[model samples]
Target: DQQVKQNSPSLSVQEGRISILNCDYTNSMFDYFLWYKKYPAEGPTFLISISSIKDKNEDGRFTVFLNKSAKHLSLHIVPSQPGDSAVYFCAASAPHTGNQFYFGTGTSLTVIP
Candidate 1:
Protein backbone atom coordinates (compact mmCIF):
# COMPACT_ATOMS: atom_id res chain seq x y z
CA ASP A 1 0.00 0.00 0.00
CA GLN A 2 1.23 3.46 -0.87
CA GLN A 3 1.26 5.81 2.06
CA VAL A 4 1.98 8.93 0.01
CA LYS A 5 0.41 10.01 -3.23
CA GLN A 6 0.71 13.06 -5.42
CA ASN A 7 -2.53 14.81 -6.23
CA SER A 8 -1.59 15.29 -9.90
CA PRO A 9 0.68 13.45 -12.24
CA SER A 10 1.59 16.59 -14.10
CA LEU A 11 1.02 20.35 -14.15
CA SER A 12 1.79 23.16 -16.56
CA VAL A 13 2.19 26.86 -15.86
CA GLN A 14 3.18 29.90 -17.82
CA GLU A 15 6.40 31.65 -17.07
CA GLY A 16 6.28 33.88 -14.01
CA ARG A 17 3.14 32.18 -12.77
CA ILE A 18 2.96 30.03 -9.71
CA SER A 19 3.10 26.25 -9.99
CA ILE A 20 1.68 24.29 -7.14
CA LEU A 21 2.22 20.59 -6.49
CA ASN A 22 0.50 18.64 -3.78
CA CYS A 23 0.85 15.39 -1.89
CA ASP A 24 -1.43 13.44 0.42
CA TYR A 25 -0.55 10.72 2.86
CA THR A 26 -2.59 8.07 4.62
CA ASN A 27 -0.39 7.94 7.67
CA SER A 28 -0.96 10.45 10.45
CA MET A 29 2.19 9.57 12.37
CA PHE A 30 4.48 11.10 9.75
CA ASP A 31 4.97 14.24 11.76
CA TYR A 32 8.68 14.75 11.42
CA PHE A 33 8.92 16.91 8.31
CA LEU A 34 8.27 16.95 4.58
CA TRP A 35 10.90 17.16 1.87
CA TYR A 36 10.74 17.77 -1.86
CA LYS A 37 12.83 15.52 -4.04
CA LYS A 38 14.01 16.26 -7.55
CA TYR A 39 15.41 13.14 -9.08
CA PRO A 40 17.98 13.36 -11.76
CA ALA A 41 18.94 10.42 -13.93
CA GLU A 42 20.76 8.77 -11.06
CA GLY A 43 19.13 9.69 -7.76
CA PRO A 44 16.93 12.11 -5.88
CA THR A 45 18.21 15.22 -4.20
CA PHE A 46 16.66 17.55 -1.68
CA LEU A 47 14.85 20.50 -3.17
CA ILE A 48 12.85 22.24 -0.48
CA SER A 49 11.25 21.36 2.83
CA ILE A 50 8.91 22.31 5.64
CA SER A 51 8.62 21.20 9.21
CA SER A 52 5.55 19.30 10.36
CA ILE A 53 5.35 21.60 13.35
CA LYS A 54 5.03 24.65 11.07
CA ASP A 55 2.46 25.51 8.45
CA LYS A 56 4.85 27.02 5.91
CA ASN A 57 8.46 27.32 4.90
CA GLU A 58 9.90 29.42 2.08
CA ASP A 59 13.21 29.47 0.29
CA GLY A 60 13.70 31.95 -2.51
CA ARG A 61 10.87 31.34 -5.01
CA PHE A 62 10.11 27.93 -3.53
CA THR A 63 7.70 27.45 -0.65
CA VAL A 64 6.35 24.38 1.12
CA PHE A 65 3.29 24.31 3.28
CA LEU A 66 1.98 21.62 5.54
CA ASN A 67 -1.63 21.09 6.54
CA LYS A 68 -1.31 18.74 9.46
CA SER A 69 -5.01 18.22 9.94
CA ALA A 70 -5.48 17.32 6.29
CA LYS A 71 -2.31 15.24 6.00
CA HIS A 72 -1.40 17.26 2.94
CA LEU A 73 1.77 18.91 1.76
CA SER A 74 2.10 21.49 -0.99
CA LEU A 75 5.08 22.87 -2.84
CA HIS A 76 4.74 26.23 -4.51
CA ILE A 77 7.08 27.81 -7.00
CA VAL A 78 6.49 31.44 -7.74
CA PRO A 79 7.62 32.83 -11.11
CA SER A 80 7.93 29.36 -12.50
CA GLN A 81 10.65 29.13 -15.07
CA PRO A 82 11.61 26.65 -17.71
CA GLY A 83 14.61 25.72 -15.66
CA ASP A 84 12.32 24.74 -12.86
CA SER A 85 10.66 22.12 -15.03
CA ALA A 86 11.08 18.73 -13.43
CA VAL A 87 9.43 15.81 -11.73
CA TYR A 88 9.05 16.67 -8.09
CA PHE A 89 8.29 14.14 -5.38
CA CYS A 90 7.25 14.50 -1.79
CA ALA A 91 8.83 12.49 1.01
CA ALA A 92 7.95 11.95 4.62
CA SER A 93 9.76 10.15 7.42
CA ALA A 94 8.12 9.06 10.61
CA PRO A 95 9.92 9.38 13.92
CA HIS A 96 9.99 5.64 14.34
CA THR A 97 11.46 5.08 10.89
CA GLY A 98 14.85 6.52 11.71
CA ASN A 99 16.48 7.63 8.43
CA GLN A 100 14.03 5.90 6.16
CA PHE A 101 11.69 7.93 3.96
CA TYR A 102 8.54 7.15 2.04
CA PHE A 103 8.17 8.96 -1.27
CA GLY A 104 5.10 9.81 -3.26
CA THR A 105 4.75 9.52 -6.99
CA GLY A 106 6.21 12.51 -8.76
CA THR A 107 4.27 15.43 -10.16
CA SER A 108 5.85 16.68 -13.36
CA LEU A 109 5.75 20.46 -13.71
CA THR A 110 6.27 22.11 -17.06
CA VAL A 111 6.95 25.81 -17.02
CA ILE A 112 6.25 27.27 -20.42
CA PRO A 113 8.53 29.96 -21.61
Candidate 2:
Protein backbone atom coordinates (compact mmCIF):
# COMPACT_ATOMS: atom_id res chain seq x y z
CA ASP A 1 0.00 0.00 0.00
CA GLN A 2 1.19 3.49 -0.75
CA GLN A 3 2.11 5.40 2.37
CA VAL A 4 1.39 8.72 0.77
CA LYS A 5 -1.20 9.73 -1.77
CA GLN A 6 -2.21 12.84 -3.63
CA ASN A 7 -5.88 12.61 -4.51
CA SER A 8 -5.84 15.48 -7.01
CA PRO A 9 -3.96 14.78 -10.19
CA SER A 10 -3.90 18.37 -11.29
CA LEU A 11 -5.03 21.86 -10.46
CA SER A 12 -5.13 25.07 -12.46
CA VAL A 13 -5.18 28.64 -11.26
CA GLN A 14 -4.71 32.09 -12.69
CA GLU A 15 -1.65 34.12 -11.90
CA GLY A 16 -1.68 35.97 -8.59
CA ARG A 17 -4.16 33.50 -7.16
CA ILE A 18 -3.89 30.90 -4.45
CA SER A 19 -3.13 27.30 -5.37
CA ILE A 20 -3.92 24.56 -2.92
CA LEU A 21 -2.59 20.99 -3.08
CA ASN A 22 -3.52 18.26 -0.68
CA CYS A 23 -1.78 15.09 0.51
CA ASP A 24 -2.55 12.19 2.80
CA TYR A 25 -0.42 9.55 4.45
CA THR A 26 -1.14 6.23 6.06
CA ASN A 27 1.87 6.02 8.34
CA SER A 28 1.63 7.55 11.76
CA MET A 29 5.32 7.15 12.47
CA PHE A 30 6.18 9.80 9.94
CA ASP A 31 7.62 12.66 11.92
CA TYR A 32 8.85 14.93 9.17
CA PHE A 33 6.78 16.16 6.26
CA LEU A 34 7.89 18.10 3.24
CA TRP A 35 6.72 19.48 -0.08
CA TYR A 36 8.81 19.45 -3.20
CA LYS A 37 8.32 21.08 -6.59
CA LYS A 38 9.59 19.55 -9.79
CA TYR A 39 9.99 20.60 -13.37
CA PRO A 40 9.56 18.40 -16.43
CA ALA A 41 12.89 16.56 -16.28
CA GLU A 42 14.79 18.10 -13.43
CA GLY A 43 14.82 16.66 -9.95
CA PRO A 44 12.35 17.90 -7.38
CA THR A 45 13.36 20.91 -5.35
CA PHE A 46 12.41 21.23 -1.71
CA LEU A 47 9.62 23.70 -1.07
CA ILE A 48 8.34 23.78 2.49
CA SER A 49 8.29 21.39 5.41
CA ILE A 50 6.79 20.84 8.85
CA SER A 51 7.64 18.58 11.71
CA SER A 52 5.17 16.49 13.61
CA ILE A 53 5.69 18.89 16.47
CA LYS A 54 4.62 21.85 14.39
CA ASP A 55 1.30 22.43 12.73
CA LYS A 56 2.53 24.84 10.07
CA ASN A 57 5.52 26.17 8.24
CA GLU A 58 5.78 28.95 5.70
CA ASP A 59 8.30 30.33 3.28
CA GLY A 60 7.64 33.35 1.14
CA ARG A 61 4.66 32.48 -1.04
CA PHE A 62 4.60 28.85 0.03
CA THR A 63 3.01 27.43 3.14
CA VAL A 64 2.59 23.90 4.47
CA PHE A 65 -0.01 22.81 6.98
CA LEU A 66 0.15 19.57 8.88
CA ASN A 67 -2.62 17.75 10.69
CA LYS A 68 -1.13 14.91 12.67
CA SER A 69 -4.45 13.65 13.95
CA ALA A 70 -5.80 13.44 10.43
CA LYS A 71 -2.56 12.17 8.88
CA HIS A 72 -3.05 14.85 6.26
CA LEU A 73 -1.23 17.88 4.97
CA SER A 74 -1.67 20.58 2.36
CA LEU A 75 0.45 23.04 0.49
CA HIS A 76 -0.77 26.48 -0.28
CA ILE A 77 0.86 28.80 -2.79
CA VAL A 78 -0.28 32.37 -2.55
CA PRO A 79 -0.20 34.62 -5.57
CA SER A 80 0.55 31.65 -7.76
CA GLN A 81 2.62 32.61 -10.75
CA PRO A 82 3.20 31.01 -14.12
CA GLY A 83 6.64 30.01 -12.93
CA ASP A 84 5.03 28.22 -10.03
CA SER A 85 3.48 25.75 -12.42
CA ALA A 86 4.97 22.35 -11.76
CA VAL A 87 4.45 18.98 -10.15
CA TYR A 88 4.18 19.17 -6.39
CA PHE A 89 4.98 16.16 -4.27
CA CYS A 90 4.41 15.41 -0.61
CA ALA A 91 7.07 13.42 1.23
CA ALA A 92 7.48 12.08 4.71
CA SER A 93 10.26 10.50 6.70
CA ALA A 94 10.22 8.68 9.96
CA PRO A 95 12.85 8.96 12.66
CA HIS A 96 13.61 5.28 12.39
CA THR A 97 13.84 5.38 8.60
CA GLY A 98 16.99 7.46 8.56
CA ASN A 99 17.01 9.55 5.41
CA GLN A 100 14.58 7.42 3.47
CA PHE A 101 11.61 9.41 2.26
CA TYR A 102 8.22 8.17 1.17
CA PHE A 103 6.76 10.25 -1.65
CA GLY A 104 3.22 10.81 -2.73
CA THR A 105 1.97 10.86 -6.29
CA GLY A 106 2.48 14.42 -7.38
CA THR A 107 -0.17 17.03 -8.10
CA SER A 108 0.47 19.07 -11.22
CA LEU A 109 -0.32 22.74 -10.82
CA THR A 110 -0.83 24.92 -13.85
CA VAL A 111 -0.67 28.65 -13.43
CA ILE A 112 -2.28 30.58 -16.21
CA PRO A 113 -1.33 34.09 -17.09
Candidate 3:
Protein backbone atom coordinates (compact mmCIF):
# COMPACT_ATOMS: atom_id res chain seq x y z
CA ASP A 1 0.00 0.00 0.00
CA GLN A 2 1.19 3.51 -0.72
CA GLN A 3 1.72 5.70 2.32
CA VAL A 4 1.42 8.93 0.39
CA LYS A 5 -0.94 9.56 -2.55
CA GLN A 6 -1.77 12.28 -5.03
CA ASN A 7 -5.21 11.70 -6.50
CA SER A 8 -4.97 14.31 -9.24
CA PRO A 9 -2.82 13.23 -12.12
CA SER A 10 -2.83 16.69 -13.66
CA LEU A 11 -4.22 20.17 -13.35
CA SER A 12 -4.61 23.09 -15.74
CA VAL A 13 -4.82 26.73 -14.84
CA GLN A 14 -4.47 30.10 -16.49
CA GLU A 15 -1.64 32.43 -15.81
CA GLY A 16 -2.12 34.74 -12.82
CA ARG A 17 -4.49 32.22 -11.27
CA ILE A 18 -4.28 30.05 -8.22
CA SER A 19 -3.34 26.38 -8.45
CA ILE A 20 -4.19 23.90 -5.75
CA LEU A 21 -2.77 20.40 -5.41
CA ASN A 22 -3.89 17.85 -2.86
CA CYS A 23 -2.23 14.94 -1.09
CA ASP A 24 -3.20 12.32 1.46
CA TYR A 25 -1.27 9.99 3.71
CA THR A 26 -2.14 6.84 5.58
CA ASN A 27 0.68 6.88 8.14
CA SER A 28 -0.03 8.62 11.40
CA MET A 29 3.63 8.55 12.36
CA PHE A 30 4.59 11.03 9.68
CA ASP A 31 5.64 14.23 11.41
CA TYR A 32 7.30 16.16 8.61
CA PHE A 33 5.65 17.00 5.28
CA LEU A 34 7.29 18.56 2.23
CA TRP A 35 6.32 19.67 -1.26
CA TYR A 36 8.67 19.34 -4.18
CA LYS A 37 8.44 20.69 -7.71
CA LYS A 38 10.15 18.91 -10.58
CA TYR A 39 10.92 19.77 -14.16
CA PRO A 40 11.66 17.39 -17.01
CA ALA A 41 15.13 15.80 -16.94
CA GLU A 42 15.80 17.27 -13.51
CA GLY A 43 15.32 16.40 -9.87
CA PRO A 44 12.48 17.54 -7.73
CA THR A 45 13.21 20.79 -5.89
CA PHE A 46 11.98 21.52 -2.40
CA LEU A 47 9.18 24.03 -2.32
CA ILE A 48 7.65 24.28 1.13
CA SER A 49 6.97 22.14 4.19
CA ILE A 50 4.88 22.00 7.33
CA SER A 51 5.63 20.02 10.43
CA SER A 52 2.90 18.18 12.32
CA ILE A 53 3.13 20.92 14.95
CA LYS A 54 2.23 23.61 12.46
CA ASP A 55 -0.93 23.84 10.38
CA LYS A 56 0.59 25.91 7.60
CA ASN A 57 3.90 27.08 6.13
CA GLU A 58 4.50 29.54 3.33
CA ASP A 59 7.39 30.59 1.12
CA GLY A 60 6.90 33.26 -1.48
CA ARG A 61 4.34 31.97 -4.06
CA PHE A 62 4.10 28.54 -2.48
CA THR A 63 2.27 27.41 0.65
CA VAL A 64 1.76 24.07 2.36
CA PHE A 65 -0.95 23.06 4.80
CA LEU A 66 -1.19 20.05 7.07
CA ASN A 67 -4.07 18.41 8.87
CA LYS A 68 -2.75 15.81 11.24
CA SER A 69 -6.07 14.50 12.47
CA ALA A 70 -7.39 14.03 8.95
CA LYS A 71 -4.04 12.81 7.66
CA HIS A 72 -4.28 15.22 4.76
CA LEU A 73 -2.31 18.06 3.23
CA SER A 74 -2.40 20.41 0.28
CA LEU A 75 -0.21 22.83 -1.65
CA HIS A 76 -1.28 26.22 -2.90
CA ILE A 77 0.39 28.26 -5.62
CA VAL A 78 -0.78 31.83 -5.77
CA PRO A 79 -0.94 33.79 -8.99
CA SER A 80 0.27 30.83 -10.96
CA GLN A 81 2.54 31.57 -13.87
CA PRO A 82 3.53 29.66 -17.00
CA GLY A 83 6.90 28.88 -15.50
CA ASP A 84 5.17 27.19 -12.57
CA SER A 85 4.18 24.31 -14.79
CA ALA A 86 5.78 21.14 -13.53
CA VAL A 87 5.25 17.92 -11.65
CA TYR A 88 4.51 18.51 -7.97
CA PHE A 89 5.16 15.81 -5.42
CA CYS A 90 4.35 15.49 -1.76
CA ALA A 91 6.62 13.68 0.66
CA ALA A 92 6.42 12.72 4.30
CA SER A 93 8.89 11.49 6.87
CA ALA A 94 8.77 10.24 10.41
CA PRO A 95 11.44 11.35 12.87
CA HIS A 96 11.49 8.08 14.77
CA THR A 97 12.04 6.06 11.61
CA GLY A 98 14.99 8.10 10.38
CA ASN A 99 14.90 10.38 7.31
CA GLN A 100 13.31 7.96 4.89
CA PHE A 101 10.75 9.85 2.83
CA TYR A 102 7.52 8.43 1.41
CA PHE A 103 6.49 10.28 -1.69
CA GLY A 104 3.23 10.74 -3.54
CA THR A 105 3.06 9.86 -7.22
CA GLY A 106 2.94 13.51 -8.36
CA THR A 107 0.54 16.07 -9.79
CA SER A 108 1.34 17.67 -13.11
CA LEU A 109 0.48 21.33 -13.36
CA THR A 110 0.00 23.16 -16.67
CA VAL A 111 -0.10 26.90 -16.54
CA ILE A 112 -1.57 28.29 -19.73
CA PRO A 113 -0.33 31.67 -20.88
lDDT of 2 at 111: 100
TM-score computed on alpha carbons, candidate 1: 0.92
Deviation (Å) of 113 in candidate 3: 0.8
Name the lDDT value of residue 98 in candidate 2: 94
Which digits, one per residue and each the tens of the lDDT, describe model 2 over residues 16-48? 999999999999999999999999989999888
Provide the clashing-pair count of each candidate structure: 0, 0, 0
lDDT of each: 0.85, 0.95, 0.95
Error of 2 at 109 (Å): 0.4
TM-score of each: 0.92, 0.97, 0.97
Writing each residue's lDDT as its tens digit, candidate 1 over 1-113 gives 89999969999999999999999988898875555556467476788877678899899998999999999989889989998888898988888878888899899888999
lDDT, residue 51, model 3: 91
Instruction: Name the lDDT value of residue 101 in candidate 1.
Output: 88
